[model samples]
Target: MVQSERAKMADGEWYACLDDDLGALRGVAADAVFEHNTLPPRQRGNLGPALRALLGGVGEGARIEAPFHCAYGFNIFLGPGTFLNAGCIILDTAPVRLGKGTLLGPNVQIYCAEHHKEAAGRQAGLEIARPVTIGDNACIGGSAVILGGVSIGEGAIVGAGALVTHDVAAHTTVVGNPARVVSRG
Candidate 1:
């Protein structure tokens, strides 16, 4: 059976990123993002209605500060009391789950898409997506980059400027490129 590009993407299979249907979906997400980004803080509150409606799930008291961006809002799920500071970007081509009370500092980037390595496939806009999961009460410092398929354990601390490419164990503090375990917090 032939699956839609989005279906393929959600199933973690290779898909065409430039597909028309996917483009329309992204456009819808962009509109919601626009509503969140343009509205004044006072008017916007934490998560605006449009943006909230667009997301897959947003738990009670969860707040996403504006100047935020995402490839598709529907793929993101935020737990209750989770706080995402300003300038956070999520490429939610796949599901991105942030557990309750998780805090992401400003300018944090979460990437869910991995492009094809071959030049021909890359030019064709081929790519695969993987889910990113951050456990409850975790703290991710500013400017950290969390790559796809990485699962951050509960209460884990990711240091600023760290590049996370693998799973981070619970209660561990990881710093530096490749995110080595510096301490067990």
Candidate 2:
């Protein structure tokens, strides 16, 4: 979890900040790219417009494929040569940064915002933000769900369907639920 004093401010206070308030200020800015479909296609290629529109503010060399979804565009920053495949959903209520050459497989879900688990907080429908960082050349496999405030180090490979809830070291191979490293860097 993020222990920095800057990360712990209340939601109301945070939403008042310029950087953190973009999602609320521009809710669904890419709606033109996200058209309603009774049954959305399972394959990729339907996401190009959405990706382009979302990354309009980021660097020019960044690449994001179709069949992806994100909560807000500003909260995500992609380095050059980064690629996200089909069925990727990023709840980027907080910052989600992918380093250069980072590759994400199909069905990858990266979440930077999490709701409180406490009974009172849950009932109140409160959520908090944390950052997710994927280092250079990391490969996240299909159907993995990465939780808040976790970092995948450089050259790490996360196996398919893994649920990563903690930090992964550089060049490690992590698989299964909660994602234990099978090979050390």
TM-score of each: 0.98, 0.76
**Candidate 2 similarity to native, TM-score:** 0.76
Candidate 1 has which clashing residue pairs, if any? none
lDDT of every predicted structure (CA atoms): 0.96, 0.72
lDDT (10s digit) by residue, model 2, range 123-146: 654567778999999999999999
Per residue, candidate 1 scores C-alpha lDDT tens digits across 29-50 of 8999999999989999889888
Model 2 lDDT, full chain set: 0.72
Mark the regions of model 2 whose C-alpha exceeds 4 Å error after superposition.
Answer: 1-26, 30-53, 56-61
